[model samples]
Target: MSGERARILVVDDEKVIRDSCTRILTTEGHIIKSAENGNIGLEVFREFHPDLVLVDLKMPGKSGMDVLEEIESIDPNVVQIVITGYATVSSAVDAMKRGAYDFIPKPFTPEEILLIVGRGLEKRRLLLESEALKVEHERIRRNMISLVSHELRAPLAATVQYLEVILGGMAGEIPSEAKEMIVRCDIRLQEMLELLRKWLNLATFDSPKMAEHFQDISLSDIATESIELMKSLAEEKKISLILETSKDLPPIKGSKVSLEEIFNNLISNAIKYNKAGGWVKVILYGREEEVWVEISDNGSGIDEEHLSRIFDEFYRVDGRRNAPIKGSGLGLSIVKKMVDAHGGMIDVESKFGEGTTFRIGFPKFFQRQKEG
Candidate 1:
């Protein structure tokens, strides 16, 4: 009774027992309420939301087990203790099966009643704490989604408006160099948008009811398309783009869209971080059970310390000070997530001031001789 006092409800058909129990609990500095029968007790339970409930098994209107079921339906976490006069071992076992926290005989001492009530109150406190933690976690997740949405949308919107003007010829007689610059900007914007979409999709996939789509597709074709998509950006920077893929490469079983996105992000990053007039090489090789793809670039390589956290969301190697080469910092993270979704593995090898290489391994699904 020295601990925190809890709100308790006493339910019994006997007026004397109900009143006496309420008096004893109230004297101990605990808030108490009394109900004549189980039906009335249920009404009081909804209104009071007591932390603990004490119900007599032999009731006139509704049985104690009935009351326990109703209370559990209202809030399963509410602690329930059963009291009975003709207490048999079987009856006590039955009460526990119906969700009662504990049982006490009618002729029990005040000390016994207080001890059982205290235990029930402690259980209630733990249930409330668990519910609070779950709610807090959900709130933080929502906040993260809101922040990422606002931060990613602004740059994408600007890029879209610029492209619309150029494509509409609203900016009349644009120079070839200026058009190419706009297109490069457009590509970066598209990359940012794709990263955002991947993050959102990953969240959806984490739900238990979501399904993943997998299919058999040619890894060589997917890699080639990704390389061609970023070829313009490489040309603009005077970077040489090379693709070395075996003609007899095996197909991979996975989501083609996800695979394409992963390759696109890696290849784009290789171009983005490469030095002017440097080179990017993409190679594909088929093994017995799996296929390997590597994208390597001659550029400013990632530092050893920062490489570990490169896959973290919104994590950038260069701070905001590096405006000319700044990125949204979600490309590699998205790539890693997509690879994981496909049940594949991806790794990065880099040395500072030298270059970086990203290697991905996929399970082979098609016969290499089909194309021949």
Candidate 2:
């Protein structure tokens, strides 16, 4: 049995063939439109907007081949089946290549017409169902990520606060050994918090709600703010944080939070992975069409092979994974998605012993800018 009633268009120059196809298919629970000539076939096809089209291979005026070409130009996804008395392997092959789903020979039986039409419609149903499943899977995956991250956030945040008080000796007198253990626990909890936050941010990154907050933003200002926030981390490792920017970088269009996030993730990683006394440089420049920001770090550089897959979700470079680097491997993944959403470009340059640099460019567009 067919999965669903499909809207079908029958385009054959012969009245008998077109009428027979319509009678057989319409009886099989489909809405059918029949056209008597090649030119009319193309017209009806566009107006019908059918799930399947049954077109003859040869016809007068425009010819079935010409109709097929026009139909392909209109919407290639519309399933087309060819009808022809001159059935040959070469002709069938040509028809199929030109986007025909199946071929019907002359004098096809009622059963044959139904069977072939049913097969083509079934293919359409499966393709739609497969795509729906994929969308559902992604929805579930993101929902789970969001749910877990938010649920764990409160307790983890409280834990960090209380741990801080205790470590600061505000709770009471504690032994040095116990303080050391608590510090370790606190570090682990902080790491977990970072992971949860990233997960939550990633889940909401591409949401339509977030897109509403986009506005013209200062690239240099955001870069300066991110640098200030990461200064302590860089100082702890004795790493130099350098900022080089053209003061006149043109404002680019994007969610301010998203742009700031890009700065945070890239700068944070540069500092985290750098050796003591290393330097991380952030450069912001403006081209005619877009604004570009580059974050470079002279630290433990990424390997050649790892560079390609670095932006992939939850994938860690072998060096970063084996080394003491701390991350959920989702930072660059988030960065890449955000860049793509802005219709921007991102590039990476690295050599194992030298260093790594990440450059990102955002398109310049002012669409009802707001003061931020």
- Which candidate's TM-score is highest? 2
Backbone clashes in model 1, listed as residue pairs:
none
Q: Tell me each candidate's TM-score.
A: 0.57, 0.72
What is the per-residue lDDT of model 1 for residues 253-301, given as tens digits with 9 covering 90 to 100? 7777778878888888888888898999999998778899999998889
Candidate 1 residue-pair clash tally: 0
**Pairs of colliding residues, candidate 2:** none
Question: Cα deviation of 194 in candidate 1 (Å)?
Answer: 6.8
- Residue range with the least summed lDDT across 10 consecutive positions in model 1: 204-213
**Residue 98 lDDT (model 2):** 82
lDDT of 2 by residue, 1-372 (tens): 256789999888789998888888878789999988888877777778888888888887887777887897887667788998898988988988887888989999999998898898887776667777999999998778856765688878988999999999998999999999999999989988988888777776653556577777888989999999999999999999999999777888778888888899999889988899899999989888888889999988898988899998889885455556767989999999888777788999998977899999888874433322
What local distance difference test score does each model get? 0.82, 0.85
Candidate 1: deviation at residue 197, Å?
A: 5.4
TM-score of 1: 0.57
